[model samples]
Target chain A: MLSETDISAISVTIKLALLSTAILIAIGTPLAWWLSQTKFKFKVVFEAIIALPLILPPTVLGFYLLMTLGSNSPLAGFLEYFGGGSIAFTFSGLVVGSVIYSLPFVVQPLQNSFSAVRIESLEVAATLGASNIDRFFTVAVPLARSGFITAAVLGFAHTVGEFGVVLMIGGNIPGETSVLSIAIYDHVEAMEYSQAHLLAGGLLVASFVMLIFVYLFNRHFSLVRSRDW
Target chain B: MIECQLKINLEGFTLDAKFSVPDQGITVIFGPSGSGKTTLLRAIAGLEKGDSGFLKVGDSIWQTDDNFVPTHKRQIGYVFQDAGLFDHLDVSGNLNYVKKRKTGLKKVFIDSIYTLLDIESLLNRRIGQLSGGEKQRVAIARALLTNPKILLLDEPLSALDLKRKNEILPYLDSLHNQLEIPILYVTHSQDETSRLADHIMLIEDGKIIGNGPINEMLTSFEMPLSHSGDAISIFEARVISRDTDFNLMHLEFNGGQFIVPDNALPIDSLVRIRVAARDVSITKKKQSDTSILNIFPAVVEEIVPEGNAQVIVRLTLNGVVLLACLTRKSSASLKLDKGSSVFVQVKSVAILN
Candidate 1:
């Protein structure tokens, strides 16, 4: 028995998580690939930056993102000019925050998986007349599918569970930017324990199920794929 | 012809190799481990860059001072020691991955490779399900599906067990015989070199010590074959007849006839016979009755004492140089010396081709 507001909150949460995960994957794949393959002098610095979110408190990150996306900031002004709206208190701002918050979860696994792909296979693909892009899709991507799956699931689940960053940036706009975690916070704040229980239980079950599915599916695929070699 | 003059420096080793191979037939780079055989193959494939080099395959110049075509542009297919098949791809998917990107589709078809490597049964199976031999076969098929101008086999058989090696050798032989493309086969095994190579390049410590036809190169006394303290001789012969009564095949060469224990060879099939120096006994006179089926007249070309106990005898039989290894005691008792005529009684001969 969920209320209309709770359903709206769930829809917004799903949209934010899905959009953030998609953006993270699209941007993180090549960045992770470069981090995995390149022998540059400052590789450790880049790796540390990608992994910063994992170690830093979410409020600290959210503070920086909120300030950067404020109406007076250059990025916010640019988006305002382009879209005719400020991104600071919108759903888009929450998405941008979540993408940064969950980037390491998406990138680290992808980097590890891309690094684990056999160099010999890439060389073999090169010798077979496959171009650089061709080799990446044909050999590297397929070989690292399990890593991609793990990264996607973790990014999605991690984004769903986010509270501090969303609370700071999204500001609990009921039907637009208020996601499930924020809605749960609002319910508990008003002493509506029953509504809080429903949302909390749903998120708990979802996070557990998503993580279980990721681990089980990754293990099954890795075992089957590695055995063929 | 494929000509390469490369000067590259790796950690603690340098490869300054210059060689040219014919546009057809298998030219095997025979060497020991860490002898730069694979490095040379990689350089030819453009997978490894040299400090300065000139590479020409057929009529296309791949690498020069200014033009360095990357590996993807070169129409070359390389099979690594580990097969390097895409683990996520099934057998057919692995084969088709390259076929789809190949620009020159008129050269070779996918179905031909499926039949050539006998991989039709493995089409739907994943790579993890395949045996080592089956994986190598699929790798070969994947490489062939690209219809490359040249095929580079970088110790493709070295990773397999002896049984797996035996299982995959015939497909390699058929690849050698049926395909017109030139192959640069890298191997450390002399047996594989003898069986698959039409020409041999003996590499040691990053240099070509010997380069010529396989038969002539095997018999060259200046190579490590002489240093091994065993006289080695390679005779080119053809199957003339098979003695079914004795389960032997009669081979005719320029020097003389020999009997080898082998089957599955039809008449007039060209083959190479390897007569180990240690298995040949030199006699001053021909014996009337003996179990040895080969006794040819030979003139002693050279006699070099191998060590404290053995002497290596180089003999010329009908203008072909043959080697024989004997104990110093046997050499002294038989009065072996250069310029002396003798009867070479071969205790055993192995059919290498």
Candidate 2:
């Protein structure tokens, strides 16, 4: 049976994953688009920075983020001007860390799909009287539908599985920063094997079902089935 | 008049063009492939920007020295080689996409353009569902709904097969008859040139080689077109009567009458006939025993040498001038030269719709 702390931890995990996924979509879309379309010389540098979290140790990222969010850091001083006070050990701070950890998972699929879109399609839209912003919405976005689905699934799933970054920044404060992975850690530390097993089992089943749904939807809904002209 | 002057560098070739087109007819930009024909059309439509030039389309200066209008803001419709229809939209939806940008019109041309293009049955069909010819028709209709002052077609038929080309050509002709706006059509086919163009602008090596009415350009001695298989005279004639028993139709031109083989057009219908130069022979005197159907007294204007063994004779029968190819041996035996009066024999002529 699941304990009360396990329920709270599950609720906190869902909140973090949902908020980070939303923020990733809002910010990552334009960044991925620029990466796909730009011909700048420093494009390689931007690409390398986004992909750093993919291979870097999660604890290392957590350590750097910890320094950046501490009260004594320059970034914290800038944030204090807006009354944001030391963001370390806060829920919002955990969201910022999860978003960074899942950045490559969301952006790589999007950039590949955006690059696959033909230039002629955009030129045709322009000739039809659509401006730059209008073409981006009407043409590019609709054509990259599959990419969006893959990116959202991977991003949300990756955030929910994150443990090191969550523990480092938003440390377990029961009902505040104690997510499912952290609760399972506590159950193990306190020698409560059954409680840890219940929470871990729930997360495993939930992630599996979500990933299955995405694969099934993509297979059945091939974007506008091609007609035999 | 549309005055265009542009100079630009592309790849390894340089395009330097200058020409004036009439405001209200089909002006075909003709050339072999890779001759910068489509590039010229692109420059005029603002899809291509050159270093320096002026494009004045009936008083509105689209581009000059420092000022320029982008392609979408200019009042022009463009049709690419492939249909380039929006794959996501049905035929009607594609047309509506452009119609929404129209500022002043109260009524949409949905029914008229679709009907004229013979695409009424395809309004609800997705773009991918249509065949090559059907797609082109929808593309043309979509461009028409935009209500542009000039229509730019860049090798619109080059992507289709011969059978499809023949099927779609009549609608293009009907469109030319109905619409008074100037159409800048690009093509390399001689058949399309002869059938659709009112004026022809020939390009080669990225240079303007010739520009004039189709009839004048087809018969000019200075043009290389007159020496090729495309050498033919276009005469406007109406059928006067048909001898059904003999299988011959009598057609009357401004100068004289011709008895051609029985054809499909009804009597009293005006038609265009293309007479090939090779089918004509010259005789010093009118031969009564000959089986030739057309015989007219013509005065030789000039004789141009074609290689070493043959010469092209420029002859005027009444007021229409056409080319006649004769062997050097025949020319020497008949004593033919400029101002020589002779009877010309025409073996056959093709009837062009």
Please report the candidate that would top DockQ against the real structure.
1
RMSD (CA, Å), each prediction: 2.4, 2.6
Candidate 1 residue pairs in backbone clash: A227-B128, A228-B127, A228-B128
Task: Give, for candidate 1 chain B, the lowest lDDT window spanning 10 residues.
Answer: B223-232
CA lDDT of B191 in candidate 1? 81
Model 2: per-residue Cα lDDT over B8-92, one tens digit each? 7887987888998898889899999999998998888787888999888887889888988887777787888897887756788
Residue B205 in model 2: lDDT: 85
Query: lDDT of each structure?
Result: 0.87, 0.85
Tens-digit lDDT track for model 1 on A66-89? Answer: 899878888878877787655777
What is the lDDT, from 0 to 100, of the residue B300 in candidate 1? 89
Tell me the TM-score of model 2: 0.92
* Interface RMSD for each of the candidates: 2.1, 1.6
lDDT of 1 at B97: 80
lDDT by residue for model 1 over B163-212, one digit each (tens)?
Answer: 99999999998999888899999998878876888899888888988888
Highest TM-score model number: 1
